[model samples]
Target: MPVYLDHNATAPVRPEAVRAMTDALNHVGNASSVHRFGRDARRRVEDARETVAALIGVQPGDLVFTSGGTEANNTALRGHGRTRTLVSAGEHEAVLQARPDAETVPLRSDGTVDLDALDVALAADDRPALVSVMLANNETGAINPVQQVVEIARRHGARVHCDAVQAPGKIAVDARALGVDLITVSSHKLGGPQGAGALAVLDGQSVAPLLAGGGQERKQRAGTENVPAIAGFGAAAEAALADLVRMTECAAWRDRLEAEARALCPRLQVHGAGAARLPNTSCLGLPGVRAETQVMALDLAGVAVSSGSACSSGKVHASHVLRAMGVSEDDADSAVRVSLGWTSTADDIDVFLDAWGKLVRRHGLAADAA
Candidate 1:
């Protein structure tokens, strides 16, 4: 079996999610219709919305179910009546793509946004600015100081939008306590089926519709709801919350992988090691090797990993996150991300270590000869 170490890209769908989706698939109705079947579908959609809200500590009324994180991000950035936008330098493409006129916030050395610099950006006289930053980075797994950023944004009368797509099931994402105006999450990131996601706008705040149709999502997002996918997302959230024990248990395996990687290559640099990170993630840079080369080598050796953001996969560009962190072009080009999840086992980590050791040894020998 191919040892899947790329959980940051996407996780395998959980069995419970599959079962829930299968059950919901048997039913059919447009949630907007007034018929009994439509009412039932609407009930299911609301229930799923509540479950998603509970997962992130937000009121059900505040959640707006969308196609996925991309749409949610677009809605959050474009809607909500915010005039100006302030985006973090290390945010995912979803956030960047939605920001038509945004000033990029500077980043720290650990792949996190520079809070002071962000404060300066917000200090601009642009009233009612929207600040878009990721709760956890999709590439480096770097957790941003979102609460602090929000506090600063609030000082400047700015609204905050956090892309929590990579945070669900990996970290505690309390939308209320985090004090953000808007937050986006994707179902697939938490082991649910794709085409299901939500954007929670804080109480008393509202965004205009991204799509226009029969009013769904309380008219915040208008389209035919995908009840089956919503059911799967709800089940996945339930399963993931229940599996917190397993998620915590995977930390040791991740640490083992990092240890083995360090032992194999003494010069290996681990990003975000200075700050707290998700237990499942490790972003390491090995000098004298290109990230794509290493990724391809590992794939050939039956181990999967990523060079940078999965959204930018197959592209030959250096990581924007790394550059934002002030990482040199060469170092950024050589960095690879190895993330673990519920499906990862200790044996899988050991096998990965063994493969990495062989590859490192071969590369070291080649360097010596050169």
Candidate 2:
């Protein structure tokens, strides 16, 4: 059996979610209709909304379901009508490309956003501004200090938006505690179906709809609700909440993987090692081997991994996240991300280590010893 270690890209669907989706798929109704069938479908959607909302500590009424994380991010970043936007250099392309004109806040060497730079940038302009920062980075798994970011943005009257898609199942994500005005989350990241996601608006923050249509999602988002996917999302949220302890336990395996890899190649670079990171993620770099080469080798060895975010149409390029943290171009090109999840086991780590050890012995040691 192949060992899957790329949970940060997407996790295998949980049994609970599959059951819920299957049940909902058998139903036939439009949630917008007034008939009994419609009411039942609406109930499922609302129940999902409540569950998803609880996962992030937001009001059930505060969420507007979208197609997925990318749409949720675009809605939050673009719907606010802010003339000026500031996003961390390490953000996903959804946020970066949402407003190509947005100013970039540099990151510290540890891969967390630089709060000082954010403060200075927010103070630079008097125009209405939106500050977009992620709770946990997808590639390096570095957890940003979002509470401090909110405190800084509030001083300049800038609304804070957090792309929290990577944080729910792996870490505690409380939008209220973080004090972000808007937050984005995805279903597949938490073992749900991929087509569902949510944008939570907090403290009476109003966001204009990206899609204009009938009175759905309280007119915040317009379209017929995707009932089966929403049901699966809710079921997945509940299951993920219950599995938090197991997720945290994966940290030991992740640490061992990094430690063992370092033993094989002392020059190995673990990006974001100096910062608070998600428990299951390790961005490892073998200086002499290119990332694509490592990924391909590991795939052939029956251990799956990724060079970086899977968003980029199956291409392996130098990680922009590493580059933002001031990693050298050569090192950036050599890095691959290994993320664990609830389905991961100790044997998975062992298989990865075995494959990685051979890879280092074959391709890395000679270059390092030179």
Candidate 3:
């Protein structure tokens, strides 16, 4: 059987989520309608809202459902009406492309956002500003000091938005505790259906509607909800919470994978090694082997992985996140991200390591010897 290690891109749908979605698909109703069927559908949607809200420590009423992480992020960035925006250089393209003109905050060599630079940028202008930072980076799995980011933004009267898409199942995420005005999360990242995501707006905070239509999502978003997908997302969130310990255990497997890989190739580099990272993720670089070449070789060996974010349209370009952390272009181009999830096992890691060892011996060592 092929071993899958690309959970950061998208995890295999959990059985609970699949069952929930199947049950919902058998029902027929519009959540917006007021009939008996409508009420039943609406109940499923509300139940899901409550479960998803609980996952991130928010009230059900504070959550607005959207298409996925991308829309949720756009809603938070554009709907907040902040004339000025500042995002970390290491953020996903969803935040970066949302406002191309937004000022960028540089990252430290460890891949975490530079808090001192953030303070200076926020102080640059008194214009209403929104600071967008991620809870955990998708590529390097680097965890940012969001509490400190919030503290700095608060001193400047700026609102904070955190794209927590990669953090839910891997680490503890508490929006209230983090003190951010807005937080975005996706279902697929947590083993749910891909079409569903939510944005948590703090009780006192307001974001203008990104989609205008008959009032839905408390007018923050306006579209007939995808009931089946929402149900699946809810089930996934509930399961993810219960599986937190399992995720923590996977950390040991991840560490071993890296340790063994490094033992085989002493020149192997682990990006963000000095920073606190998500337990399931490891960004490994073998000098002189391009990331795409390694990914293809692993696939041929029946072990699946990726070259950083899967959003790159099937092309393996140098990682922007690595460059932001001051990694040399050559190293950045050689790095591949291996992420584990609820379904991963020690056997999966061994298969990956076996494939990786061969790739390194065949190509990586040749370059080193040259």
Candidate 4:
């Protein structure tokens, strides 16, 4: 069996989530109707919305359900129509894809946004500014200090938006606690079905609507509700919260994998080891071994992993995250990410470590003999 270690890309849907989604699929009614069936459907949708909101410690009315994280991010960044956007250098492509007219905030060597630098940028003339920093990095699992960043932005009179997609289920994310104007989360990253996500906005924070249609999501996201996916998302949030205790075990597995990789190849370096990180993620670099080559080798050995974020084009690229962290281009190109989740087991870790050892021996000897 292949040992799967790519939770940062997307997690497997949990059984409870699947069941909730299946049940919701059988019910029929538009969420925006006054009839009995419509009211029932609308009730289910709102109930799910409330559950999702509770998981993140926000009022149910504050959550705006969207297609997924990409849409949520777009709505958060573009909707405000701020003239300047101070986006972190290590942000996910969804935020990085903002218009060139927006300004880029270079990250510190540790992959965290430099708030002092951001303040300097925002203090010029006091125009409307938007600052977006991710709550966690997808590749390195480096957790950003969003609350601190929010404080800095707020002091400079700038609106703050956070992409908390990778932070959910691994770290605590209370929108009320973080005090950001907007936060984005994806259902798929937290063991829920894809095509379901939410953007939590504080009571007074308003953004331009991304979609305009029959009033749904309170005229915020105008479209027919994705009832099944929303139900699954709510169920998954409940299930993930129930398994918080399992995170410690997953961290042990990640540590063992890193130790074994270094034992096999002493030159291996784990990214973000000096900073706080999500316990389930590790990005490692092995000198002279290209990430794509190791990824294919691991696949052949029945141990699956990835160089970085699994791309829509199915091609491996050099990691932008590592580059922002000051890793040399060669080392960044050779990095691979291994992440764990609720379903990960010790046996899976054993399989991956054994496969990695075999590949290192085979390749290391071949290069030596030549």
Candidate 5:
């Protein structure tokens, strides 16, 4: 089997999630119905909510399920009645596109948001404003200084929203500790099924519905719940919660891949190396090779990796994240992202290193053995 090194893209669904979803599929009742079947279905949905909410450290009543992170982000951005929005340069497209007119905060060369720049942006505007910063970047896996962002925004009287879609199972993401008003999380990001995610709100904070249906999701969101997907999400959250204590162990795997690759190509540039990053992610630049070329070559070599965000549809564009961090377009295009996951193993790393070594040699950039 091909070594899949792109956990940041989407992880393979966990067996636990699959079983939960399949069992949910066998159920017969609209979660909105008032009968016994309906009540049972409702119980499952609520249980799932409680499970997921606990995993992210939010109150069950404060969470609202959405189709995915995109809708959750959109609800937070647009639902608040045209409030000014300021987002980091490295935020996912979900938040960036949620408000095109939203002001863009600059990033340091290492890809973390520039807090001083954020303070300036907030000061630049006097209107009721919202600040959207991510907990962890999807592309470079760089962890943002969200607590600092919160302090700055709070002093300036701005509401803070953190898109922590990539953070739940991989690190500690406490909503109360971070003290943000809103958080976005994705199920598939860890091991849950796709098509289901949530927007977590601080108590008393409200968001407008993107799709107003039949008063589902406590009227915070509408439409009947996708019980199967939601149940799967809950299962994934349970598993991820159990694994958090050991999540840092994955860093050794990421470090191994990075060190070996750099050893093979001494000039390699690992994006976000200058900042705090997730333990499972490494964004490596092969200098002269286009990211698309590297991705395609790696795929052919029985390894799967990506250029930047997996949010795109079959297109390999130069990374806007890297560009925002002041990397030249040439360097941005030459980088590829490799992310490890719960199932990643040493064998997987070996397969990746062999493939990457071949690519380095093919590009005439192989490192000299000392």
Candidate 6:
């Protein structure tokens, strides 16, 4: 069996979530109906909403359920009628592609947003604008200075939309404390079903509906609710909160893997090391070994990793995240991202280390292999 280390892409569903989803799947009700069954279904969704709300320190009524992080991001981006946007260069493609005409703010070498550039970018435009900045980067796992971003946006009369998909379970997230106008979070990133996510707004902050139908989600998101997925998301959210204290526990194994690799190849480069990154993630580069080669070799050796961000189609492409950080094409092509999660174990780290050793030796990068 392969040791699954690509948890940032998608974590295995937790047993608690599976049980919640299964129970909901066995029941019947349209959350929009006023009948008893509908009321029960609505209760389930609201309970789940409360759980997710607590995860991010927001009121339950402030969130609108969505299909996933991508939709939540797209909804937040286009939901606001602001004519222009200023997005960080290191953000996920969802934000980058959301407002194609939005001006870009360059990122620093450490993978954090350049607040100086953001101040300038926001001042460059006179019209009211929306500023989209992620709480944590999906590829590098570097935490962005959202509070600082908010301060800058306030100076320029811009609203802040933060993509906090990689945050809840890995860090202490309080949406209100961050003072962002909008926040987006996904369930699957923390061991829930894939199709469930939410777009949360700060209290009294309004967002235009992406879909207009029955007055579901306070008319912000319309459709029959996915009861099973939402229940699963709630269960996962509770569990994630319980597990948050253990988030940094995985760092020991991650650092061990990096130390082992560096011992073999002294030229190994670990990205985002100088910044406050997610405890579960590491993006590393082997000087001459291509990312594709390392990923395939690790798979063959019963370990799983990735070449930075995994596309929606499961294809490995050149990392826009690395490029945004001013990394060279060659260095970017040679980088791979390894992320751990709730299911990760030290034994899994051993499996990855063994595979990494052979790959480095085979690629003629093992100076310390002896």
RMSD of each: 1.8, 1.3, 1.4, 1.9, 1.2, 1.1
lDDT (tens digit, per residue) of candidate 2 on 207-313:
98999978899899999999999999999999999899886579999999999889888889999999999999999999979999999999999999999799999
Model 3, 1-370: lDDT tens digits are 9998999999899999999999999999999999999999999999999999999999998899999999999999888898899999999999999888999999999999999999999898999999999999999999999999999999999999999999998898899999999999999999999989999999767898789977888888999999999999999999999899897689999999999989878899999999999999999998888998999999999988999788878888899999999999999999999999999999998898888888888864732445
lDDT of 4 by residue, 292-343 (tens): 9989998998877888777446788788888988899999998999989978
Instruction: For each candidate in the order shown, give its overall lDDT on alpha carbons.
Output: 0.85, 0.94, 0.93, 0.85, 0.90, 0.90
| Candidate 4 collision pairs | none
Model 5: how far is 306 from its true place, Å?
Answer: 0.6
Candidate 1, poorest ten consecutive residues by summed lDDT: 361-370
Residues 70-161, model 1: lDDT tens digits: 99999988886877888998888888878757889988888788999988877866677888989998877888889998899888888899
Off by over 4 Å in 4: 365-370
Error of model 5, residue 140, in angstroms: 0.7
Lowest lDDT block of 10, candidate 4 = 361-370
lDDT string for model 5 (1-370, tens) is 8998888888889898999999989989889999999998898889899999998889999899889999999999888764688999898999989899999999999999999999998998888889999999988999999999999998888999999999989998899889899999999998999899999988787877888757898898888899899999999999999988776778988998899988999999999999999888899998989999999999999999998788888889899999998999999999999998988888999999998899899888997644
Cα-based RMSD of candidate 6: 1.1
TM-score of 3: 0.98
* Alpha-carbon TM-score of each model against the true structure: 0.96, 0.98, 0.98, 0.96, 0.98, 0.98
As for candidate 2, its clashing pairs are none
**How far is 194's C-alpha from truth in model 5 (Å)?**
0.9
Ranking by lDDT: 2, 3, 5, 6, 1, 4
On a 0 to 1 TM-score scale, where does candidate 5 land against the true structure?
0.98
**Residues 159-261, model 6: lDDT tens digits:** 9999999988999999889989999999999999999999997777777877877778888888888999999999999999999988878877878888887
In model 5, where do residues sit more than 4 Å from their true spots?
none
